[model samples]
Target: MNRDRSLRYRLAGIEIFAILLALLFLAPFYFVLVNSLKTLGEILVDAASLPEAYKFTNYSRVWDMIRFPTALRNSIVITAISVAGIVTISSMTAYRLVRRPTRFNNLLFLAFISSMIIPFQSVMLQLVRVTSILELRGDLLGIVVCYLGFGLALSVFLFHGFIKGVPLEIEEAAVMDGCSPYGVFWRIVFPLLKPIAVTVVILNTLWIWNDYLLPVLIIGSNKDLTTIPLAVTRFFGQYTKQWDLALAGLAMSVTPIVVLFLLLQKHIVEGIASGSVKG
Candidate 1:
């Protein structure tokens, strides 16, 4: 009876701790949401407290200033195209690497893995220069290409791990059934990648959607191609920051991705866990 009571107590303590930890992570969200409804002065005076009166006008003003629709369209298009390219290229590449396992393929796989360790900061200058030379800078294609390049290594790594778990016999069976190599991959192998593909999409979407630095570098001075992150920066100037509008823009920026994450979050854990175990 005493042991049972002790175990119960321990479990309860763990639950309490988990709840507190979750709230700690959620605290920033609370502040962003609550203060977004307040005026700049109200935020300066008491950001921690709820506004005396919610000023939803902050969102309206932010929407117009940031050109929310254009920003949203840019972010959506870039994220979608980039993620699709990443998935298609990475999955095929991973499939080939796993099935072939030639010396060159092994070396290539190692190269891909190694590139992940190289910091993005280290290559930014060279990337900018190269993009300028290629006339890729300040274009949607430029940013999307950059995303594909940077996103490939990690996506390939994930796909590689997951592909290992897929039975070779399945591919062999498809081949024997007269399925073309392309058909075998697209019809057979690719479908099985749905879980990890969802993981890849969700991860990259969040990264690309919220990314500012890459867009700043590649889409420089192109107001037409401005993403939400770049658009929101208009609220913060060198001398003064519009805290209310900034927070409102942030709230708007995060909503779509947050909804996406909430819907597909289970796939992330499931895919990663499965990949690790299968690998």
Candidate 2:
């Protein structure tokens, strides 16, 4: 009875700590949400205090000004295309690298893994030059292509480990039954990769969705292809700061990603855990 009580106490303590930690992390979001409903005068007066009156007009005005619908569509399209391309290409590449062992393949895998260490800022100038030479600047297709190239390394590295854990016997059995390489991969192997795929999707979605710099660089001066982060940036200029409107815009912007995380959260945790397991 005493041992059971002690264990219950420990679990309760952990639960209380976790709840406190979550609240601590959510503090900034609370500030944003509260301040978003207040006027600039109220914000300047006391940002931490609750709003005297809720002002939802900030969202409406900013939404129309920033062309929220167009920007949202662009962000969705770009993120979906980029993430799908990353998952497909990286999974296939990782599978091939696992199955076909060669000296050059080893070198290539090493190169991909090592490339992760290189900072993106160092290559930005050269990338811009290449984009200009190829006339890829301001193109949605060009931006998606850029995301594909940049996201591949880490994605392949992630899928590589998980693919190794998949059983060879099952693949061999499928091959003996007159299944082609494509059939075996698509019908057999790919389905088994769902867990890791979800992890890849979620991780890539957050990165590509939240990314501001790359879009700014690649899709410069293009209002049609504006993303959420870039759109939010417009409220802040050299001299003027639209804090009231900006906060409201930010709250609206982050809602989708936050909702997505909550929905797929279980899959995400399981996927990462499974991916980390050794073959």
Candidate 3:
């Protein structure tokens, strides 16, 4: 009886510790949200207090100043295209490499994996110069290509791991049934890779959508083509800053990602966990 009571106590203690850790992680978000509703004066005076009066005007002003609708559209288009390209190319490449497992395939896979370790800063200057020479600077298409190149390594790495766990016999059976290589992949292998695909889509979507550095480097002078991150940056100047509007703009920027994660949270978690296990 005493041993069972001790086990119960230990379990209760663990539950309490987990609850505390969860609250600790959530505190910063609570701070951001509550302060977003407060006036500038209230935030400065007592950030912990609930807003004396909720100011919906901050969001409205931010929306107009940041051109939220336009920025949102640009981000969506860029994210969608970049993610689609990454998933399609990476999935096929990984599937082939895993199925064949030749020495050359292994070498190519290592090369792709090695690219991830090379820091972006090391190549930033050269990338800018090359893009300028190619006349790709300040173009959305240029930025999209850059995103694809940088994002491909990680996507391929993830897909390679997941593909290894998939059974070879399935593809063989499809081949014997007279399915073309393309048909075998599309009709057989691709559907089985749905989990990893969702994982890749979610990760790349978030990264590309929120990316500030690559877009800034590749895109210049084109206000119409500016992404949300670049547009929000306009609020911060060397001599002056629009703190209220900036925070509001950030909140607006974060809403879509938050909503997306909430909607796809289950799939994202399952996909990543299963992919990791298989990889």
- Backbone collisions counted per model: 0, 0, 0
Q: What is the lDDT of residue 209 in candidate 1?
A: 82
Please identify model 3 stretches exceeding 4 Å from their true place: 100-103, 238-241, 274-279
Off by over 4 Å in 1: 272-279
Q: Model 1, range 4-112, lDDT digits (tens) per residue?
A: 9999999999999999999999999999999999998999998899899877999998888889999999989999999999999999999999989999999999999
Q: Which candidate do you rate higher for lDDT, 2 or 3?
A: 2
lDDT (0 to 1) per candidate? 0.88, 0.88, 0.84
What TM-score against the true fold does each predicted structure earn?
0.90, 0.90, 0.88
List model 3 lDDT by residue over 1-279, tens digit each: 999999999999999999999999998777777777777777788867777878878889879887899889888888888889889988988888888889999999999988878998998899999999998888778888888888888888888887788898998998999999999999999999887888889878878988988888888578777788888787664214455566677888888988988998998788667656754
Against the true structure, candidate 1 reaches a TM-score of 0.90
